[model samples]
Target chain A: MSRKPIHRLPAWALRTNGAVVLLFLYAPIILLVIFSFSASRIPGQWGGFTAEWYATLFDDSRLQRTIAVSVRVALVSTLLATVLGTMSALALERFKFRGRRVFDALLYLPIIIPDVTMAVMMLMFFSQSFSLLESLFGIGLSKGFATIVVSHVAFNIAFVSVVVRARIAGMDATLEQAASDLYASRWQAFRFVTLPLIAPGVLGGALLAVTLSLDDVVVTQFVAGPGSTTLPVYVFSLIRKGVTPTINAVSVIMLVASLILVAGSVGLQRANASRGRQQLRTSGGNS
Target chain B: MAEAKRERTERRRGFLLALPSFAYMVLFFAIPLIIVLVYSFATRTSTGSTSLSDWNFDAYRKLGEPIVRNVVVRSVILALVTTVICLVVAYPFAWFCAHQRQTVRNVLLVAVMIPFWTNFLVRNYAWRILLSEGGPISSFTEAIGLGETDILFTKLAVVIGLVYAYLPFMILPLYASIDRLDRRLVEAGRDLYGSGPQTFRRVVLPLTMPGIIAGSILVFVPSMGAYVTPELLGGGKETLLGSYIVTQFLTARNWPVGASLSFVLMAVMLVSTVVYFRSGGKNL
Candidate 1:
C-alpha cells in the first residue's frame, strides 16, 4: 500500500507527538490510581503505598449504600432504555411516516440539551405535579428511585435510539420479507429474522445506557431525594469536604468496570458484523 | 378475510411496540419542556409554587441584565475556545487512527472512548490533582524550568479540562469521516502537482467539513453548559451558565430567576445550533 509523504517526517516527531497526546489523556488517570494506594493524606503528596484507602472505602457504609443505589438505577434504566429505544429504532427505520424526520430530531433533543437544564426542568415538573401525580396514579413523584430511573431512561433513550437506528439502516429488509413469505407470521418473522439481525445494536445500546446511567451525576443530583444518594453524588459531596484516597479507589473500580463492558461490546459488535457478512454471502450465493 | 385480519394485527403490534418510546418522550421530554416554558412566564410565589398570572415578558427581559449577559458571553467564548482546541488536537489523532491498520484503529478508538465511560466528575477531579501545586503536572513544569505556580483555578485549567473531556466527541466523528475518505483523491491531487498543504486544503478539508460541523456542535454545546468541570477546576472564580442556573435554584432559592435563566440558556443553544447547522448547509 502506498503511504502519504507525511510519513517521511522524522519518526521521533510523530512518536513524540503521539506520546504527548496519550500522556495528556492517561496521565491523570494513572496518577489517580497511584494516589489511591498512597498512604499520604493529601492528594498531591505521595507517601508509601498502602491498601488503607480500599479498607476505608469498604468501611464507609454511606458510600456502599450509594453504590447499591446507583447500581439499581443503572440496571433498571438500561433495561427500560434498551426496550424503548429498540422499538423506536425499528419503527423509525422500517416504517414510512410523515413526521419521521421530526421524530428523529425530537428523539435526539434530550441528548443535546444541557444536563443541568434538563435536570432542573425535571425537578420543577415532578415537584409541581407531585399532588397531581399522586391523585392520578397513586404514586408520588419526587427525588427518589422512581424519579432517578425515569430521568435516566429519558436521557439514555436518545443514545440507544441513535445506535440501534444506524444498525437497522445497515440491515437488509429482504430477509424479513423472505421470512414472512415462507408463511411465517409477523411475530415469527421479527423473532426469526429481524431480532437476531439487530441484537448487536441492541446490546451496544444497552451497554452504553448502562455506562451513561452509572456515570451520571448532574441529572441524578437533581432527582435524587435526601435519602437517595448515588455514588457520584456522594463523591461530589465528599470532595467539598476535601479529596481522599478512597475516592480514587472508587474511581479505579469504576474504570475497570467500564473497560470490561466496553471490551465486551466491541467483541460483540465484531461477532455480529462477521455473522452479517456470512449471511450476506450465503444469500448472494443462493440468489 | 384471514389475511386482512393478519395485516390489521400486524399494524396493531407495530403500534404497541412503538408505544413505550412515544410515551417516554411525551411524559419526560415534552412535558418537562412545556413546564419550563410555562414557568418562564408564570409568577413564582414566596413559597416557590409557580402560578399562572398576567403573562409578562419579565423573564425574557431579565436576559439582558449585565450579569446574565456576561455569563452568556463568557459561556459562548469558553465553548468556542474548547471547540477549537478539541479540533486542533483531535484532527491529528483522528488522522493517525484512520491511517492505522484495522486492529490498531479499533484499539486506538477504544482507548479514546474508555475515558468517556468513567464518570466525568471523577475525571475532572483527577485534573484538579494534576494541576495542583504539588501535582505531577506542576512538578513536571517546574522540572522543565517553568514556574511552579498553582494553575488549578485559572481559566487555563478550565480550558484544558474542557478540551480533555470533549476531545473524544470531536475525534470520533472526524475518524468516521476520514476513514471513509478516498485515498485516491489525495494521490490524484499530488499527481496534479498539488503540494501537501494544497491537497489537505482542497480535498481532505472540504470532505470532512460535515464531520467537523457535527463534532463542533457536540463539543461546543455541552461545553457551554458544563458545570462540573468549571466548578471543580475554576476554584469558584469562573462561573458558566450552568453553575449560575444551579446556584439560582439551589443556593439563591430564586426559582423564577433560575427558571428564566435556564430557558434563556436553552434558547441561546438552540439558536446557535440551528445557525451552525444551517450555515454548514445541512438539514436539521
Candidate 2:
C-alpha cells in the first residue's frame, strides 16, 4: 500500500474520479428503488409514494410462477453442481493424472465461451437429440424445467469447481495424511479431515452457483420452452412491453434479496478466513 | 507390490470421482461445440431450415455480405470503445481503492458488487429510464443550457448502456491487481533515480499488466456479444452482432447462417483468450 505518489495525477482528481464512478453505478439503482414505490403508472417518473406496486406484484400469478420456477432451478442446480464440482476439484487437486491439462481446459471452456454461443449450441444439441430419440422410440423430451436445469448445471459445475479447487489447493494436506497415519481409512481421512477444512469453500461455491443460476437470462431464454420462463426472462418481457412501476417493484425486491445474500456470503468468507488462519497457527504451533 | 497396488487403487478412485464432471462436460460442452461446427458448414434450405444432408461453405461466404459485415464491424468498434472507456475510468478508481484503508477498501469493493448482485436486466432497464427523453439527465442538460436532445435510441445511449453494464467487471479485477502491488519494486525503481512517472511507467504499470489485460478481456468479450443493452437502450434500431445473430434464428429462421456466425465469434474469442494466456496471464 506504500507505493510512491503518482504526481502526474493529483489526489483530489483521483478521489473525484472514484466518487463519480461509484455514483454512476449506484444512482440508477437508488432511482429504481425509489420509483418502485411510486404510485405512478409511468416507468421512471415519480408521482406519489405508495406500496401499490408491491401489492399488484403479489396478485400477478404469472410472475409468481416464474419466480417459483427460478427458485427451484436455482436450488436444485446449485446442489447438483456443488456435489459434482467438489468431486472434480478433489480429484484434480489431490491426485495427479494423465491428461490433466486437457481435462482442466475442457472444464474451463464453459467459463470462457460467451453465453449466446453456448445457448445456441445447447439448443441445437438438445433438439437434435430429441429428434433422434423420437425417430427411434417415439419419445420426446420437452425443453422445460429439465432443459433449464441441465443448461444451468453445465456452467455452474465449471464455476463451482473453480471455487472449490482453489479452496482444496489452499488447504493443508498434512492433516489428511496425519489422519491416515492414525489408522483412519481413506474415506475417513476425507470425511473427518478434508471435509471440515473445505466446507467454507463448498458453501461459498454453492452460494455463487445459486445466485448465478438465479441471475442467468441469456442461456435460459434459449433453452426455455413453453411455460418455462424464469423471473429474469419474465422481467425482460415486461421491459419489452414498456416497463411499469410494478416491474420496478419486482426489480427492487430482487435486488434487495440478492444484496442480503451478498452480505451473508462475504461475511461467511471473512469468518472462515480468520478461522482457517487460527487453525493453521494452532496446528503448526508444535513445529 | 502393496505400494504399487495402493497407487493403482488411488488412481482408480480419483478417476471415478472425476467421472461425473467429465461426463457432463463431454455431453453438454464438447458435443454442443462440435454441433455448432457441423451446423456452420451445413446448408440452409429454401424454407430457411438448416438441412444436415447438404454441406457447403455458403454460410461462411455469406458472412462477408455487407449487412452482416456492418453489424460485425459496429460490434467490434463499440466493444473496443467500451473497453477503453472502462479502462480509463476504472484504473484511477482501482488505484484509489487499492490505496484506501483496509476496511474502506472492502466497503468500496462490496459497494461495487452490490449493483452487480442486482439483476442485470433490471439494472439495464434503469439506464433506459435514466437516458430516456425528458428523464432526469435530459432535464439536467436543458437546465445547464445544453438543450433537451433525444439520446435514448442512439449509439451514444448504447455506449452508455455497455459501459454501465461492464464497468464493474473491469473495476474488480483491476483493484485486485493494484491492491497486490509490490511496494518494494516502486521504492527500488525510485532508488535507481527513476522519477515518479518513470517509476510508475516501469514498475507499477508492468506489475498491474495482468489486471489490465484481464479486465479488458472480461469487459470486451461480453460487450462484443452484447444483446440486451443495445436492444433496450438503442431501441433495437441499430443492428449489432448480438441482435443480428439472434435475428437469424428467431426472425429469419436461418439456422446455418446463425451457427456459422457463432463459430466465427467463438474462434475470435478462443484466439484472444489463448493469446492473453500465452502472453503471461498467470492469475487467470
Candidate 3:
C-alpha cells in the first residue's frame, strides 16, 4: 500500500513480542511432552528418552477403566446434545414465536455460567431431586454415569445450538420454501433440504460436545460417584496427589488427543467457510 | 379464519420442535439455579446437614465475615490483576495480528487458540511442572548463577497461570475489534497533523472500547471464580473464592453458606455478561 503510517509498529518489535507470547503459551506444554518420555521417575530429571511411561499407562487397569467411562459418557452426551441443539437451532432460525427471546436467553445461560458454579448447581439439584423422588415415589438415584451425561448435555446443548444456529443463519431460507412450494411436506423439506445443508454444523457441534465431555474435570468431580470417574477427573486427582512419570504420559496423551480434534474442527470449519464463499460467488445477489 | 388457523398451526409446530430442549433446560438449568437460591436461606445444622425449615439470613450475613471478605477481596484483586496483565500483553499482539496479511493473521489466530482447545487441567499441570522446584525455569536460573527460584505453589505462580490460561480470551475479541476498525479515521487524524499517540487516543481507543470491555469481562469473570488454577498453583495455603465455596459444600458440609456464595458469584458473572452482550460482544 502507501508508505507505512507513522504509528505502525516496527516489524522486529512485533515479531519479538509475538514470539515471546507464543513461547510463553507453548514451552510448558512442549516440556511436559518431552518429560513424558524421560527414563527417570523424577519429573525434572531427564535421564534419557524412553517409552516406559507409555508402556506403564497400558499396564494400569485403573487408567483403562476411566478411559472407558469417559468415552461412553462423551458418546452418549454428544449424541443427545447434537439432536437437542439442532432442533433448537431449527426452531429459532425458522420460526417467529412468542417467548422466543426468553428461550434464547435461557439457552445462553449454561454457556455463560462458570464451571464451578455449574458443578455445584448440578450437585445440589441431583441431591434434592433424588430425595424428592424417594419421598414421593420410592425411586432413588445419585450422581453417576447418568448424571454426568445429563450435566454434559446441559452445557453441550448451548454450544451445539450456537454452532448449528450459525450454519442455519447462513442458509437460504427460500430453498426450504421452494421445497414446500413443490408440494413437499414439512418433514420432507427438512429432511431433504435443510438437513443436508446443515450437516457440517451438526457434525462440528458433535465434535465439540465430545471434546468438552472428555476434557471436563470440575463438573465431573462434583457429580461423579465412586466407580464413575472419567479419565480427566482421574488425571486431575493424579496431579493433585503430586506429579509422577505416569501423569506426564497421561497429559501428553490428552494433549495429542485434543490437538487432533482441534485440527479436525478448524479444518472442517475452514472448508465449510470456503464452500459458503464458493456458493456466494456462483449465486451472486441471491440473498 | 383459514389464515388464522394456518398461523396457529405454524406456531404450535414451532413450539413443538423446540419443546424437548426447552423442557430440558428449564428442568436442569433454570430450576436448579432457583434451588440454589432457595438453599442459600436454609438452615445448616450443627451436624452439617442442611434443613429446609427455619430459614434465616445467617448465610447472607456470613458474607460480611472477615474470613469471607478476605477471600473475596483476594479473588477480586487477583482477577483484576490478571485482566490488566492479559490486556497489556494481548492488545499489542492483537494489533500485530490484525495488521498482518490475511493468511498470516489466520495462522496467528489459530496458534493462539490451540492452547484453548487443549485440556484445561493439563495446561495448569504443565505450569505446575514449569514453576516447580528444579523445573526448567528454575534450572535455567541456577545455570545463570541466579540460584534455583522457588516459584511454585505461590500466589505469583497462580497469577501467571491465570494470565496464561485466559490470554486467548482477551486477544480474540481485541483482534475482532481491531480488524473491523476503519483505517480511514486513523489516516484522517494523521492528516490533521495529530501525533501518533493522539490519533490512537482520540480515534483508535474510543472505537475499540467495546473490545476492551468485552475482553476484560471474559478474562475477569472466569478469573474471579477460578478453581483449577488456584487449586493447582496457589498450594491451598491461601483460599480463593472458588476453592472456599467448594470447601463449604464438600468439606465443611455447610450448604447454605456455600449456596449463598455461589449465588453471589453467579450474580456478578451474569451482570458482567449482560454488559458484555450489550457492548456487542456476541462474537463468542
Q: Taking the candidates in order, what DockQ does each have?
A: 0.53, 0.70, 0.70
- lDDT order, best first, reads 3, 2, 1
Q: Locate the minimum summed-lDDT window of 10 residues in model 2 chain A.
A: A1-10
Over the stretch A51-165, how does candidate 3's per-residue lDDT look in tens digits?
8889989999999999999989999999999999999999898886777888998998887788888989999999999999999999978779999999999999999999999
Q: Write the per-residue lDDT of candidate 1 for residues A42-130, one digit (tens) a residue.
A: 78668998988888888889988998998899999999999999998987887644455666777968877889889888888787689
Q: Pick the winner on DockQ between candidates 1 and 2.
A: 2
Order the candidates by DockQ, highest first.
3, 2, 1
**Structural similarity to truth (TM-score) of each candidate:** 0.92, 0.96, 0.97
Q: Listing every candidate in turn, what is its Cα RMSD in Å to the true structure after a full C-alpha superposition?
A: 3.0, 2.0, 1.9
Q: What is the TM-score of chain A in candidate 2?
A: 0.95
B1-284, model 1: which lDDT tens digit per residue? Answer: 99988677656665666677877798888899888887778666677665677577676677799988888898889989999989987887788888788888878887887777666777888888788778777788888998686888888899999998988898888888888789888888888988778888898888888788878888888888888888888876789888888887777766767788788768767886787676563532
The CA lDDT of each predicted structure is 0.82, 0.86, 0.90
Residue B240 local lDDT, model 1: 87
Which scores better on lDDT, 2 or 3? 3
